[model samples]
Structures are given as C-alpha cells and as structure tokens.
Target: MPYKLSATLSAHSADVRALSSPTNDLILSASRDSTAISWQRATDQPGFVPSNVLRPSSRYVNSITYIPPSADAPKGFVVTGSQDTIVNVFALDKAKDEPDFSLIGHTENVCALNATPNGTIVSGSWDKTAKVWKDFKLAHDLKGHQQSVWAVLAVDEDKVLTGSADKTIKLWQQHKAVHTYNGHQDAVRGLALITDIGFASCSNDSEIRVWTFGGDLVYTLSGHTSFVYSLSVLPNGDIVSGGEDRSVRIWRDGECTQTIVHPAISVWAVSTMPNGDVVSGCSDGIVRVFSTSEDRWASEADLKEYEDKVAGQALQAQQVGDIKKSDLPGPEALQIPGKKPGDVKMVKNGSIVEAHQWDSASGSWQKIGEVVDAVGQDRKQLYQGKEYDYVFDVDIQDGVPALKLPYNITENPYSAAQTFLQNNDLPLTYVDEVVRFIEKNTAGVNIGTGGNEYVDPFTGASRYQASTASTGTAPASAYMDPFTGASRYISGSGSTPSQAPSSAHMDPFTGASRYSGAASVPAPTTNILPVTQCNTFKQANVAAMQSKLHQFNEGLQNEISTSSLAMYPQEVTAIDEIFAYLGQTIATPPQQPSVTLTAAHVEAIIQVLSRWPTSQRFPVIDLSRILTGLCPRVLDAPGLKDRFFEALFKASDWSDPWSPPPPKPRETNILLLLRTLVNSFQERAGLEDGAWPTRVFESLSQAPYAVLTKTQRVALATVLFKFVFSTKPRAPRPF
Candidate 1:
C-alpha cells in the first residue's frame, strides 16, 4: 500500500513523443502535446506542474534526440524530427519563443530520429529512407528496406541500425549494408546496440532477436503477446522492451526478469536512467517513470482475496431478518394471547416504530397497547377480546415497522363502561391530568398501493434503492422484494389468539421487555432527562457546522495547528462538506420534529449552508426515489446529509427536524465518495498522471486541498471548527 505517485510536469497537449534519461536525477519527456517537460525527484507532495511549456514544431513533432555535445560541434543543439517530414535542430539553452533553422528533404513523416557522437543527425522516415545530416545538410541516404524505414540508431559515425516495415533490421557501415537480419515474419519495429553483440531488433512478431556483425542470429527471446515496439540494452546485457501490451519487460541471459503493466496509452518507447529504473512514453499522451523493485503480485492477490472474503461474510450477516413489514392491525385487534406478525410497517429508516394510545382520552400520538395487572383486573384475559384504550401497542414486521392504534374500531365491545368516564377509557379508571397533542396525519394509514415498501414518498428516500443490496446486508434476491411492495412477514397459524396456551406468552419472544403481565411497552424510559445545562457537553460544539464557520480559536494553546494535521488533498475538501450536510438536515426531519424549533435555529443553519455548494440536486432516473428528495429551500438542502442520502432520509422524519450527525466525516460517508473515485482511477489507469481528467480542474492543477478525502477533512474541520465557534456574537440588529 505504500505507493508513490508523482504528477511531475504535465504541460503536454497530446501524447508524449519521446523520453530520455541523461541522468538518474531527472526525467525528460518530449510530447506531441507540444512540449518537453522534466521531473526532478520523488517526494510526499504532488509534483509541480511544468515550469515551462515549449512547442518544438508548428505541426507534429515525431522524435527527439540529445547528443552529449562534443568538442567539434555546437554546445547547445538538440535534434528533432517531425510529421512534416523535415528535421530541425534547436538550442536547448534558447528560449521557446524564437525559432532556428531546419534540416529538410524527407517527403513523408519522420518516424524515428537519432544523433551520432560526432554531431551527425540521422532520421528514418515513411519515405523509405534513412537520411544522415551534417552541418544541417542531407549528406547520405542510407537505403536498403523496400518499405518505410520506421526506426534509426547510430552506434558511431561508421555503424548504424535501421529497422523498417519491410520486415528487416539492416546493419549499415559507411552508408552501405554491412549485414541484414530477416528472420522476423512481421515488421521490425525497434533496434538497439548491445556493445558486445552486434545489434538487437524487436518486431511485430512479438519477439526480440540479437545478431552479430556477420549476420549470425545469436538469440531469440519471446514473451510479448503483441508487437514489441522499443527496447534498451542494459549494462549487464539484459534487455528491456516496451510493447502494445501496455507493459514493460526485461530479459537477461535469455530470461524475462520483469514485466510491469502500465497505464500509458500505447507503450511506444522505453528509456533507462543510470540508476537502472525505467521510463516509458505512451500513446495516451503521457510519459511515466517507474521503479521496478518489489514483487508484482505479492500484495495484489492477498489483498483481493481478503476483500472478497470480507464481502462474502458481510453479505451473510446483513441478510438476517432485521425487521418485518406488516399491515396496521384491524379494529378487532387486542392483547391476543398468541399472534405472529402480519404485513405491517415496522422498520422505517432503521428504527422500530411504536404506537401511542388513542385515549378517546387525550388525543395524541399516544401509547396504544394493553396494560399490565390492575385492581383485580385479569388484564391478560380480561382484555383478551376487548381493546385496551389507555396504553400503546408495539410490533415489528419484516424488517419494517409500524405503530398500532389504542382504540380498536369502537372501544373494544368486551369492556364494561361507566356512565361518567372521562376521555380516558381503561374500563373503570380514568386519569385526566396529561394533555398530549398529535398532528392529524393520515398519510401512512390509507390503502393506496399498500405504502410502497421501498420508498418514502414524503422525504424522497427512494434515492438509495440500488439495483444491488447494501454491503453487509442481505442480497436483494434473498429477501422479500421491497421494490415491488412485497416484504416477508410471519402469519399466525394453527391456533387462535388468546387460546394458543398461556405457556407461550410466559416467556414472551421479545426479551427486551421486563414487565410482568399482558405485554404492553414499558413506558418510554424515564431516563429522558431534559437536555439542558445538565446535558452540557464535555467539549463545546463551538463551531457552527456549515460554510464560513465561526472560528473556534479561544481554547487553543499547546494544540497542533490543523493546517498540517492530515494534509491530504481529499481531507481538505471534505471539511467543507460535512457541515454543509448538517445544515441541510434541520430543515426537515421525519414526522413533525419537536414543537420547540424556532426560526432563529433555521436562519443560522441556512446562513451556514449558503457558504458552500448545495447538495439538493435534481432527482435522476428510476433511481431518483432513493437518491434525491425535496430541495430544502432554507437557503435549500435536506434533513440529513450522509453519503447514503436516501437510506438515512427514510430513517428520518420530515416532521421531526432533529437528526444525528453522520458518522464522522473523516471516517465514513462524506469523504468516501472522493476516496472511491481516486482509488478506482489509480487502479484502472496504473500510474499515469495524464489519465486524470483535465476537466477535473482542481486535481489537474495539483492543489493539495483538491482531493476531498477523509483525513484532510478531519484536519480542516479542526481549523474551520475553531473559526466558526470563535466568532463574537453581534448585538441584535434593527429591522
């Protein structure tokens, strides 16, 4: 996992034309994108963009060469060839704005170019000839191949190697063929001089063959699945070749020592630095330098297998029934002695639902289930057929949830009513002190489409409904299909309620309940102390979670500066997003959030959100229902901003505006998006920087804060949090 990616110099507008490694410290690349750029060395930060951009040709530049300038020649000239078929030699020390003279006469595209030690320029062209230039004038036309000469190499003034489409690599001495090797069945694409051996040739036959000056074939190495385009002879006599396979391979003593798959478009050229590392120029308009040091498949297989196993295990566990869906209980519903769940709404947004009694009593979202032992009331059998109107009812169905009513159709006919009973109707007793209020919401109660199981119509939770199942959750194929309005639930069979035998009710299935009697939900926990000064946080939530946060600088002294806390490009961008989501959630929660909300909290949240880009984008396709929802206009957004927007929304109440903070931005949902995108590209494209989308301007520009990853978000939050919470409160402003 410890890999280093260098962006280096990226001024090219097209595929890199050539590459050269004059020293181990620098990487040189010539690109048709109109410039030659250099990278110095490796570091933790991204490499800098090109310090300069230069155009070597008015048209396409085909090849370039560097001659360690000698005593008899000019000190600064670098030779270059073009598709225009002409050769131009320019000064490396000269500024890019000015043009120099040109060496002309090839009537077709120059495919390859090279320079001899003696200041002699050699270029091979599709014109089917190898031309040598001296003093900027064509001196000799080395002709032998019957087809286009594709590559040329000069070992010295007297010897040269020229490969061609004519299916041969010919050794020429003083402009005459000294030897010819023609065993290859396809076009010869490359040639390299072995110092001890005569020459080396690579062909479209996917083979590399070495030969002697006498035309005797020395050895043939084969491994490439496609054309071998370029090769370099090593000091140890090993050979490294680049081919159409997008790979670089090394052969030594008749064996392939290494093969590295790269992301460059077409592995067209290869070069080696003095340190023995390799550099490659590819057709995708890029040049890459890589270190060949570790075992290629060692971590890959282990990592892949590990990931697969983890995924499989998670699939099994998440599939277990988490809840069930059921239809709302009917009027005859009561404290049944035995009843299994039916199709009822149970799990909504991951939380189980509970019913509140319908105290024909206090009108409200009250508890609606049966009560425990009362004054001589055999509550269990006494209310077996009669509905209990004082308490609530609770049931879970098919990994879904629902709340049952307290009053069965018409005051459970089994009850004996007193003449002057208050709104409270528990047969004989009535308590009239507590007044509860409930919003008259008939939305989920109707029989329309049986309440689309896979979607939340009000908050737009259909967005998260993916074609696939959730990770660690059951596969869609394993359960009742929520998308089709169908979810699996259990139905009571073989016996009637109240008569299935009391032994079954003695050890009631849901173990969470500890009360003794006809099952009724114990009252909502008395642990709900009012959240006030007693609930003051150990750490002040000083910073406002939104854009343009107020600073939280007052408490810091010996603290580390967050500027460098986790300076990854990704973490930085996420700092601005987590708060953006928090601001959106307060606008709408599932059900009417608390009645305690005020316009001030609303305005503050809006003000904070306005400083960042909004996430309330338009819904898309059939997937829209789970992924998108109402665009909150409180300077607009939603009630929760987790990466799984739809899933969380279904769990929230559009009426209840309170929501839990999404898992920390640095660890979960928010930064996960950018992390996935970055990781996918790095894998699919190997190590080429050019594969990065130029349209993604921030990353292209090498901005440290452009990544939007998790770690950086945490660090950025540290800083932004201070700024948000540290602002001085202003006096009330006049209208």
Candidate 2:
C-alpha cells in the first residue's frame, strides 16, 4: 500500500522548514515564523495537535532535533537551530517563550541539526563549519569545509558526518576530518543514515547518492526534478525525501516507489516516525503526516478536499519541464494504463492542460493539477545543474563569447553581480552596470515580500523594498532594514543624524545598517571636534575570502584574454602569506604570523586591482583594506601611498558621476575604499606629506553630498573625523 494523508497540522503562519519525528506520538517542527512547535498525537483522534510552541529565535528556526530526557528536563529537550546563528534547547515539560539553553558558536545561520542517543548534538551552519555540543557546552568545532555546511548527521557519540554546499561529504572523528566523499555535482542539501550500507545524500543536482563509509559509491537515485532539501529513513528501510519539486517521494532499493505530490511550491523537510509514517514540512506552512495504514488515514471528506487542493493548483509549464501544448495528447491519454506508480502524463482537455499521475494503490490516474502559462513563465531555468530565476547572456567585450549571469530573484543583486564578475574574471567596476542590467530586466516584478522575503540576518543588505503596484520604482522612504524593521537612513532634508530613528544608524566600516547599541556621538559643534575615535572594519572570514580569490584566479588562468590578469607566482605567494598572516591575527588568542608582510604583498594587491576588471577587483581591494589597517608601514615608501589611493579610486570608479542609490557592488567598493581611507589616518600612515590625502579628499569631493548613500556618507564623515584626529597636532591654528 502507498502512503496516504493521515493528518494535517497547520498553525505556523509561514513556511515550515524542518521536522523531527522522534516517535509515533511526538513530532517537532521548526518554521520560518521563528517558532518551534511540539505536536502530540491525540488520544481520542488520529490527528496531532500543537502541544507546545517554543520561540527559539526572532529569525527563522531552520533545523530541529530531539534529545532524550534527563534529570534536568524530565520530558526531554527539543533542540532547534535558527538563522540567528544560535542553537536553542527547549524542555517539553517547561515549554515557554524562552529556551532552556542557548548554544552560540557558529558565525552564520545554523541550517542543519542532528542528535545522538547519548544526548550529544551536532549542528551545521552557513559559516562553513559544523559544531558538536554535549551537556549544554561546546564540545568540538568541526571546521574544514570550503563552503556552507548544509547537512549534518550525528552517527554516534564519536563519529559525525557533514554534507556541504562545496559538494563534498565529510566523515569526522571529533574535530578532525577523517575522509571526504565527493560525487555530488551541486550543493549537497540533505543526508540520512542507512541501516547498514553507509548513508544517502541528496543535492541540488536533483540526484540522490548512496555511499559507504569505506569511501565506495553504492548507487544513485534520480527522480526529483529540483533541489532535494531533506531526507529521512523509514523503519522498513525505505528512504523518503522532499524537495523544491513539491513532492515527497518514497524510494526502495534505488527506485522511486511512490511520489506524494504537495499543494505547495516546496516540501522543505521530511522525517519518518517509529511506526513508519512519514512527516513533511512544507512551504505552505503545513506539517503533514502520511501513513500506509488505511485505518490511520484521514476521513474520506478530508482526503477529497486535500486531493481537490492539489488538483486545483495552477502549475507553470516549467515546473513539469519543457512542455509543448501542441505535442500533448487529449483526454484519451488517460485511457491507457501507466507502467509505474509515480508516472506523470500531461493531457490537453479542450483549452485546459491537466497533469495526471498514476497511483498504484488505487490503480488509476489521479489528476494532480492544471498546467498554465503565467507571466515570467520562463523564470526557472537551469544553469550549471542548478535552477535559477534568470540566466542572462552578458557580453563583456566585442568578439568574445558572452558570459552567463545566473541569478535568483530572491538573491541580492550585488551578490549576483560580484559572483558573475568573479566567475568571469571581469573587473569590479562593471558591478554597477550588471546591477542596472538586472534591475532593468527584472523591473515591475514584485520581490522581497511574503514567503520569498530575504530573512537572513547576515545579508540584510540584499533585502528588497516592497514596491507599490502603481509605480515600478521601490520607494526610497519605505526602505526598511531587514534586521531591525526600521526605515534605513535616507539622506535628505528633515533627516539629520540626531533626528534619525534610533535604530537607523549605519555602520560605516562594514556598510551594515543594523543597530549595534553604540551610544550616538553628539554632532560636531564649531570644529571643537566630536572627541570620538573611529573604528575600522577588521573582522573577516579570511579562509573564505582566500578561497574566493583563488577561485577567481583559477577562472582567469583558464581563460585566454584574462590570462595576463591572473596572479603571478610570487603574487600568489604574497597573497597567500597575507591571508596566512590575517588568519593567525584573527584567530582566538591571536598568534604571530610566520612571515611578516612586506612591500611585495602591497604591490601584489595594487597589481591585481590595477589590472583586473572592476567586478573582479573587490577581493583585492578588501585585501588592501586589511593591509592598510594592520600594516600601514608597507605603504610608507615614497609614491607608494599615492599609487595605492590612485588604484583604489580607479577600481571603485570614483571619478564617475555620482548617482543617487549607487549599484550594490559599486556601493560596496566605495564603502570599502572609504574604510581603507579611514584606516589610513592612523599613526605612521605616510600622511605627513599630505599630497595623497589631498588627492583622496579631492576624488571623494566629486560626488555631491546629496548623491551619497547613507552608509557612504557615514564612511566619508568618518574619514574626515579620523583625519582631523590623526593630524590635529600638525594642523596650523587659525590666526
């Protein structure tokens, strides 16, 4: 018998992203609404009801697991990982708004969580690291992944497994990576342990791979047409999976046995109960339970309503692959029998196109939905095995092949531009141009609202403004900070630093607009000075940045025209040495770097920034920012500071006419340049001659105050403040 809908639990107001079924009677679910719910099976009915609601974070709670009960928590603990980069534990017996323990370590969103029977918990994060915790304390920091760690499994008290966006699965023993299994062609999203034959992993490549612990490939399961988000194992050894394809599939021995379609855009998570029932969390904010037992199934009326809901969905043509209305058969196609249980057949019914699936248990074709051609129907296109909302052909130069600019509607435009520029070895200066291209093509489409809103706290700059239907332009006044929910600092009359909203202050150093609880410095009065010291943006993920720089170098190396732009052997060594220096300095209990930085490293950064395209120059510019702050002496030589500032201005297109609301990439570059300038105001910054500093201010004065973004204005102000403080003794007093 195939799985049938047993119960529908609906309370969350947003997408349910993760689920954990510890037993037949207990189910834990985390949702985008920032709440984790504990559902208990009713004694009088077959349905499950929300027994307790735990508010673990203000942001989305993305992953959940169960911990066995102990003396402190009699009813056990429901552990949740959230977008806030915090893992919280809530005891069932003391369910409340606050968590019992908040485990904080990962620097990015905690997206995956798993627990061992002995009460140890493992968490994977977008920070590219996994962490193990025991007894409510940090136990081990599993760090080796080159990208975000998206999937984690606690094999036992000592052994752990992690799957990463880098497309490799790692077996870890304590804090060290013992082995890495590579096969997935795309981001690995989900992992589930099999009874004996190692484990099964699913990826954005739309294929599920089974692998052994001994580093052997078992088999691959291919059926899902989109990114698989989750996987779970049933008691009977069958594997259940869910994905962006809106289906929950049951697989047995490498073959899909049944496909349970959902009435949602994505089935985000799937978990199995002790009795073999499958629980799924969906984008529709519903947690559903499916069971093969007919007695446990929903009533006939409820089942029919559910079926009608699925059948009434208007699916786009791309959702079912490239469908041609002319090639589809009429209603007679349903008359023939289907060979497999989950086989799909599309038939044209008069003016309507219906999608039907073969249901083996009922021995008939069930109408799933109606396919319709909607606006932006061509939106989900595949590029490099991953589905993106748009993949544009961008011509960088004449007579050269156009580069691919792949973007998702939900992604930050600046990020997309940087990625495109980085991947193509284009200059960072083109970031603004690319951003304009994206905005021009994607205009009039409402984005960054409802379920699709950008909710990640770390990347708040990417959040879009909610636009009005009357005008395509997103209102500047209505731009809200994604984290604080306060209006962003908009420069103009009636908006002064003191009068601005309390949470609207932007961090000039990082270009981050979120409130940091720093006491506001009073506005300068009569040049007496504000008497406050300025801070530099010094914190960074050195490893990730180094990886990206090398990746871009590899891209340049593989290309003909850009080969000259690739880093020379000594330049590469210099960059590596600088990164190594930064890694040690940024590490906890900072250690001295083995090799001290010299003029060669400074020259290396200058060389890259001067030659690389504008889009590809950010990392090098960022490196300059770090270098200026930490090793100002490197630029102390004659003409060195002048060359550095010249390179920075050219890389950021400082001479270009200032536009209100600069493109994200350009804005970022400008901000970094300003921060670097601020850092240059320190002692021994080689500013005694004042020639280069004059040039810096002269280039900056080109952009009118009205045209500068709030963050840029703040950074420029900081540069002036730092300059005055650094050279106040040398300043000639008024006669």
Candidate 3:
C-alpha cells in the first residue's frame, strides 16, 4: 500500500531545512529559526513529541545528523551545520544551550552534513570544500570542487562522496578525489548510497540518476518537476526524495511509484527510519511522518484536514507549466481515469480553471487547487533568459524607457542594487535610491522574519540596523565590488574640466586622477601616469575558446609523442567546469549561487599551458585571462599567484630577449600574457603584497616599450595604469 501520514510535529517558528532519523523512535530537525529540535516517541505513544531544543547557532541551522554514542556522550550527539560557517556537536544527554564540541573550519555557510556508523563526520560548505572530523578534531580537508558543495555522504570511515552546485559528483578516498561523475545539468543537491550499487543523486535539473561504482550510469528516475533537495534510502532499497515541487516521491526499481504532495512551498529534506517510516521537513515549519502500515496512520479527521490544506492552495499557471486555458477540457474530463498515480490534469469548469491530481489510493481525482493566471500572482518573470521573483522598471529620465532591475527574494538587497547600477552604467550614488525603491516596492512580501540582521559576505556591509530599519543612509559615494573589495569608480561631478578632483571623491584608494582634466590638459602623446580609469581585457567568446581547447586536445591525442601530454581526465573536467561557470556568469541574466573557482582549476590551466604545444597554448592563455578577470580569488593561496604568473611567463618566453617581429606563436603568446596581466590588477588578484606586482613589472621591463607592437603597448600601458591607480605609492619605472 502507499504511504500515509502518520504524525505531524510542529515547533519551529521558521522553515525546517533539514531532518535526520537514526531510529524509528527518534527524529532530529534543523530550521531557519536557528534551533535544532529532538522529537522522541515513547513505547505507548502514538505520535512523536518534542523532547529537547538546542540553539545551535544565531543564524539559520541548515543541516543536522546524529552521531553514534560514545563514552563521552552516552546518548549520542546531535550535530548541526549552520549559515554562520560553524559545525557544532551537542550531547543529547545534556540540555545546555552551549555545544560540547565546536568544529569550526569552513569559511562560508555549512550546508550539508553526514556521519558514518563509526562516528566519523563529513561536512560540505559553500566555501567550495568539505572537511572530515574524527573524535572532535579535523581529520582531512576535501578540496578540488570548483563550486559550493551542497550534499555530502560518508560511504565509510575512509571514503566520502560530495555533490556540488557545479553539477558534478566526486568520490573521495580520504582527502584526494579519485573519481568524478558528471551528468547533471544543474546543481547536484542530494545523494544517497545504495547497498549494492554505487549511489543515487538528485539535482536541480529535476532528474534522479543511479550510478554504479564502476563509473557507469545505471538509469534515471524523472518524475519530479523541480529542484530535488534531499534523498534517503529505505531498508528495502526503495529511494525516497523530496523537492521544491512540494512532493515526496518514492522510487522502486528505477521508476517513480508514488508521489506524496505536501501543503507547503518546498519539501526541503527527507529521511527514512530504521523501520519503514518516512520523515520529511518542509518550508511550512512542520515535520511530517508517513508509514505504509495502516495501524500507524493518522486519524481520519486529521487526514481530512491535511487534504483540505492541500486543496486550499492557489497555484499559479507557471508552477504547472504553460497552461492553455482555451485548450483544456471541461469538467467532464475528470470522469476518465488517469493512467498512473500523481498525474495532474487541468479542467475548465464554467469560467473557472481547476487543478486535480489522480490519487491511486483513493482511485479518484482529488481537487488540489485552483489555477490562476500568473501575471502578478506568485509567478516569476523571465528577465533576459533567467527567471527572477521580481523585475522592476526604473525610469531614470523622463523621455527614456525604464531600465529593468531583476531580483530574487533570497538575494541581499545591496547586492541586487549594485548589480542593477553596474548593469545600467548608472552612478554609484544612486545605490541608496535604488535600494529604497526596492524596499518600498517589495515590502511585506519578503520571506522569513523581515527584521533579522544579515551581513553581506562579499562586502562585509550590514543589511539592517539594530532598530530593525534598512541601512539606507550609509554612504554611496564609495561602494565596494562584491567579488573584489576594490572601490568602484564613481562618475565625476559636472564641474569644468580645469577643476581639481572633487572633494566628494571619498574613496581613499583612488585619491584623484591627474588625467581628470582631460580637456584642459592636452592628451599625453606618450604613456603617462594617472589614467582616469583602469581598462581590463574581460570580453571573450567562451564557446569558441572551449571548442578550440578541445580541438587542441584531440590533436595532441592523435600524435604519438604528445599523447602522453594530453589533458588528464580531471584536468579536462576542470576545464569544462571553467567554461560552464564562465558561460553562466556571462549570460544575459547571470545565474544565481555563482560558482567559485579553486586553486585546482588554476592548476589545471597551468598544466595545460606548460605542456601544450606553443601554437596550441594561446587558447589556454586566453582562458586564463578570462578566469582571472572573473574569479580572482582563485589566486588567494600562499604561493599560487607566484606559480600562476611564472607559468604564464614561461609559456610566453618572457625571460628570453625579444627581437623585432618575433615568431608568430611567441608574439601571440606574449600579447595574451600582457592582456592577462592587465586583467589581474583588480583587488584580491594577489595585489596585497607588492612582491608579485614588482616581479611582473620587472619582467615587462625586459622588453623595451619602443620595440613592442601597438596592441602589446596598449595592454602593457593599461596594466601599468591600473597598478599605479589601484595600489599604494611605488617607485615609477619605464617599460
């Protein structure tokens, strides 16, 4: 028989994001309310009751797991990962607010956690890395993922599996990645290990895939129509998955057997008990359990009330896909039987449109909700190619059309305002105005508790003041770039050309440009200091670069001597991820949860540049130029910046004496190297310490400025201009 609701437990005041069930009698839930609750059922009790609440973090507690009992913690420990980037462990026997052990190593939001039977814990974070903990101490740091690690599973004491927002799964043997499985087109959000098979993964692409340990994809289950966030395996080997579609689906033998819909916006997490019960945490702040045994099912009155809640929701047309109201049949269509369970059918009754779902258990169609037109009702708008919760039109001038400002509810308002200003080439001073406009328009509709304070991770700017008010009065003359802390260039005042730099220029990094008076002082005929703004070579055709890279790889594979130097499988995966990230960021409307490039990706580029033939190295060098411009944090390591630049110099023969009209390959390489250097001047591109920049300048001094081509000279000049303006005072030198 299909599963039916057995119990409903509600104590959280906010969305429940994660759930774990180690036994049939115990359940743990983590919520955005910053608390983790333990629910227990006595032998004579018919339902679970909240037994203890642990305030694990001040921010949202996103993930939770149970560790086996040890001598130190007789009743076992409750582990939690939160948005504050800390993983905390608390003993179940104690009711204190403070944790017994705090495992803090992640630098960003810790979103996933899992533990092995022997008490080894593995955690994944938005920091693009995972960590293993043993006996309350750091065991191994799992690195190499190029994006946020959203899902993690401990296969055993020595093996772990991590799924990432980069749309790939990696199997790690201790701290090293041994195998990468790539098939998902969107973020891989959930994973569950099968007994005999390798594992099953669920993704934002709305597909569940089963894979074997031999790296072969067994089959795919494709009934869910939205992002799948959590997965678990039953003792009988059936797969249970929950998703944004508000449905808990059960898969048996690679096919969807049933879908249990919830009365909430999202079913964020799901787990299976030691027996046969299923547990789910939902966005409605409720934890529900379902069982196949009729004796464990809830009372008839409670089931009816739950059904009414599901039927009361008002679903927009977009949620069910494009609805052609004219083409839909009338009420008579409900008389015909649906082919399978969970099949949705829309019918027009008189002038109203209704949504109905086929229930195999009841052998009838159940009215789930009413479908309404989605113009201004809960449906996301398509801005460029990406979907956004809101797209406002801002009229900057009387005669000009309003510019479109796209935003999502989950994004920080300051970040959205900055993106809007940058996209429209507007002045940074308008940031406050844009933010106020957004707050005024989006008031009361924002999700969660509105007054909670949040700190922007990128800029370290506070989003809300202590009085529960927006921080709109903060200075806007100097705004920091989110990725790089460099001061954004604000537009100059409308004064005469001969006027000195405006005192309104508050950014200490850029005092004033001597070239600010361009009209009064004739343009310099030679390369000079203090250019108005730094010019970066950032534009690129990512598809073309990727195609050329693969072409070169194929060429190397066909040759006898070069075959050994062909890109390694991991290197190829890294390169492909680089292009994917570039494509997403450069799209008309950039994708959310942006991928972060790691030192491993930089290492891959270095390997290709060092090993590929000279003629074939330009494409790789061009890719480096784009990577540095887009993700400068990849060079944040201790010696990675030095090594990366050294590879570029070696690839271009920068140390060799230059002759006029150099070889075509060498000339192309040098030009690309110069362009890459121009892109590397932004903040966090290893400019904190002046040693690397001095080395770069010293290398360029080897080539006489007079002998360089026009393109090379222009690139070199831009690099020098940026270095001079963006950094502290340094001795001047001629190139």
Assess the local accuracy of residue 698 in candidate 1 as a C-alpha lDDT between 0 and 100. Answer: 38
TM-score of every model versus the real structure = 0.39, 0.64, 0.65
Q: lDDT at 237 for candidate 3?
A: 98
Q: Which 10 consecutive positions of candidate 2 have the poorest summed lDDT?
A: 461-470
Candidate 1, residues 28-109, lDDT tens digits: the string is 5666544555445545543333433446666656677766655433444556676667776655554564446587788776
Clashes of 2: 10
**What is the C-alpha local distance difference test score of each model?**
0.44, 0.77, 0.77
Clashing residue pairs for model 2: 427-613, 427-614, 427-615, 427-616, 428-613, 428-614, 428-615, 428-616, 429-614, 429-615
125 Cα displacement, candidate 1 (Å) = 0.3
Candidate 2 lDDT score at position 171: 90
Candidate 3 per-residue lDDT over residues 566-673, each given as its tens digit: 899999999999999898978888774255678899999999888987878988998988888877777889899999999999998887777776777887788889
CA shift of 668, model 3, Å: 15
lDDT (10s digit) by residue, model 2, range 1-735: 789999999998777888999888999999888889999999987799999998888888889999988888888999999879999988899658878899989887899999997799999998777899998899998866667888999988999999988899989888766778899998898999998899999998889999999989999998888779899999989999998777999999888899999988678899999999999988778899999999999999999999999998777666787789889999998999989867889999998999999887788899989986533322245454344655666543323334577866556667888787766434676665565455444444444426333222222211222222212222333332221223333322222122223343333346675443332222223434554656556646677679768857764654445667889999999999999988887779989878887777788888888778776677788877877877777787778788888889889988887776677667778878987888778553866786767777788788888776666677788888888778767744231
What's the CA error at residue 250 for candidate 2, in Å? Answer: 0.8
